[model samples]
Target: MNVEFINPFLVSLVNVISTMATMDLKPGKPQLKNHDIAKGDVSGLIGMVGPKTKGSLSITFEAPLILEIMHKMLGEKPSSINEEITDLVGEITNMVTGGAKNLLSDKGYDFDMATPVVVSGKNHTISHKSKGKKILMPFSHEHGMAFIEICFEDI
Candidate 1:
């Protein structure tokens, strides 16, 4: 994957999360992960396609961290990952992906994104069927940690 494509995701994550969830986010340095699966307790994933590129956008949360974010969004503590909580994860993934897509449009990376899908369980894993590598960007909130992973390939 080209490094030039990275900043859009970082910018979108910080801006969207701050405004929507009212939480401050600190991103750790992004690291390349060449693995078959990404492990997470809860995940929201979106697939993107362009004339020359194909990729997937994924956001995964720690069990408790996702609940905290849902509580903030709902203004009440959420006890479990129900339909509503799962829906919020999809919305967040959409917003993050939309923000990045708009930003990248100027660079001629205009792409179409699939509807986000949410998955939850104990250390569930997501596998990306890409021809390139994955970049894991870990973020820290006052509450806990989560990760945004992008795996893209030239098509």
Candidate 2:
């Protein structure tokens, strides 16, 4: 992935998360994760297709952060990862993707995003079809931490 392709997602993630959940998040420097399977308790994945590239992106949250976010969004404590929480994550993924898509299109990377797919379990893994580099960006909030992985391939 070109390093310039990362800025949209980074800006979108921080802006949307702060707006929707009313929480502040800071991103750490992105690093190459030399693995296919992404590790986390809850993961939301979305596929992307564009004229010049095709790939997928995922936002994975640890258990504690997932719960914290859900509670903030739903205005109640979530005991576990239930359907509502899963849907919330999916919507969040969609929101981030949409914002990134808008920004990227301005930079000439027009893409359509697929509906989000959410998976949750104890240390589950998210696998993508594309064999692209996984640029992992970790985000931290007062509640906990999560990771956003961008896998992009230029055609």
lDDT of 2 by residue, 6-56 (tens): 878888888877887787789988888876545778889999988878899
lDDT of 1 at 38: 51
Candidate 2: C-alpha RMSD after superposition: 1.6
In model 1, which regions exceed 4 Å deviation?
36-38
lDDT minimum window of 10 residues, candidate 2: 31-40
Which candidate achieves the best TM-score against the true structure? 1
Error of 1 at 120 (Å): 0.9
The pairs that clash in candidate 2 are: none
Model 1, span 36-98: residue lDDT tens: 355667899999988888899899887677788777666887787778778888988999999
Which residue pairs in model 1 clash with each other? none
